[model samples]
Target: MRRITLTEVGDRAGVSRSTASLVLRGSSKISKETARRVREAMDELGYVYDRSAANLRHARSMTLGLVMNDLRNPFLADLAVVFERSVRRAGYTVFIGYSGDDLGDQQQMLSAMVEHRIDGCLLMPAAGTERESLKVLGSHEIPSVLFARHLGGAEPYIGPDNVEAGRLLGRHLRTIGVKEAVFLGGPSPSSARAERLAGLREGFDGRVELVDGGLTDSTVSSDSGSKAVSRLLGDGTIPDCIVAYNDIIAVGVTYELRLRGFEPGSDVAVASFDDIWIASQQVPPLTSVSTHAEEVGLACAEELLAQIDEPRQNGQKLIAPSLQVRASTGSWRPRKEDR
Candidate 1:
């Protein structure tokens, strides 16, 4: 099989080979019409660019790396999809690496990405990522934009406003007549969880009693939520409202309460974070905080590209969150005395 080359593309587009090469390299010198023609010709001929040869000649591999903690989480998965589309539109391809939510895997995958000569990285660090582990990329001068979680560094980061989300949930719970709220599932090592818990406390202004869910480790699952709630029940902590870490956990809590002959919305309200698809379709739709994963992903990608272009510019980007009211947590009007 004959391999299509730049010369063939140039001939098909009726442009000089130099012009076609410039278009392939994403050079700004080429006119829009000429670049479009060359791209069309290449597409028609099914011509794939030789990135390896180009990298050898030029110092750039023209590839970006995206390393996320866990793709199984629907939120992270959605972020990856949006980030992939945004970067691809910017004329750079992406290589996605999953850390499996382990520090060792995070470091290993980052090292591998560096070895592959990736231009820059978009990282969503694992739960327990330390400063030293992230130095692997920093020391190598590989630009990185941390998304969702950070390791308490000067690196650029973009994520939802977790504290604000927590506050919103807390405020909503209080408005719905939840004087005693229990947070089911977790003592996660992630900074996001701590910020969320803090915001929830702030929202209640020390008014609502927050009972510990009695979780030993950081695991966010339906079973974990159910188990935690069961332990709370066993401990004689009858919660007026149950707040789960995320929608999945909320679902478990709701299920467990139902099994115990309690009506979720009427008997005890339920609220959670990450207004995922399942949140709305539950037996009684769950009230949740909308983290806007897609927007966060777009911001992360843009920030990464900016860092790649000008590595000196680095800071944090916090996307605001909103509360989504549903049947699980009935809305109530604020009274003058309550205010």
Candidate 2:
């Protein structure tokens, strides 16, 4: 059987299709008798309204896209919560997309968001997203705000000052008498990771010997941290400290050291970035640089809303970092010359 059409409903209601449409939309201008007749016809004919079709005519979906690289990271989980709350209060619903740090996936998800005609987007770009991939959004004139990492454009973005955060971590490890340190997990396409490494290089400048442990799996996971430790152990090189890319990696390195009969914090200090919730709950709490994920999320959301309101306005905002000292880095212990 053919699907019941709006024209049929109008015919049964003894009215024009436009009047029936206005009645179905609950327009206050519709007379009580005509509105009742249209609704009765719809019920009798079992007419199912297609909201998507109606939305296209009006031209606003009241929806926004929120795309992030890794949802497994606790920092991003927290960020999503904060960002969702702020956008919802402004009467806009969010369509979340996770790209798993893959460029193809990022492009596909962003394309879907554009096709859905979302008002705007908040993107935490994947590792290898290029200008070509983002052009899909540009072609549609869909505004986007980058979070955590950017793919290079004039669109507004909000994130932590990663270079300074890395420097902060480096100086903390150095102040604790670390003479040799291994910087684990990187060379990712993400600007955030690069900035972190650069900051660490600056912090340890002329003070400590820093070796790159290299990527174990991906730039942002504990598996990479464990792999870095394996490489170091196989090479018969163990530094006084290991600076992980994030708290997850720091936790992995801390346990890996324990399995090797090295007491973390005393024999081999471990530090990382992003003071996630688990950073302080480990056997020996992790020392880390706090990027304030929640604040960044809130700021990013606000920036996107501002852009949605005024498409021409675009800028970048950076949140400063803070150090969270814990047992993992031996911050409470008195520094003694061991060299």
TM-scores of all predicted structures: 0.78, 0.80
Work out how many backbone clashes candidate 1 has.
0
TM-score of structure candidate 2:
0.80
Residues 1-339 of candidate 2: C-alpha lDDT, one tens digit per residue: 678988899999998675687777676667899999999999999999999876664476789999987788999999999999999999999999988887788888988988898988998888877767776775565778888987667657899999999898888877877888888875487888888988998998879888877787765777777778988888998788888889888777877888889888877888888899999998788888999999998998888887665454346999999998888876434335664
Report the error of model 1 at residue 186, Å. 4.7
Which candidate number would show the highest TM-score if scored against the true structure? 2
Query: Residue 33 lDDT in model 2?
Result: 96
For model 1, how does the per-residue alpha-carbon lDDT over 1-339 read when each residue is reduced to its tens digit? 788988899999998665677687677666799899999999999898889876674476779999876677788888899999998899889988887677788888899999888888998778878777877776556778888876666668899899999998888776666787887764357777787788899788787888657563466678878887777777777677888888878888988888888788877788889898899999888998999999999998888887765554346889999999998888333234545
- List lDDT for all candidates, in order: 0.81, 0.83
Off by over 4 Å in 1: 1-58, 214-217, 331-339
Per-prediction backbone clash count: 0, 0
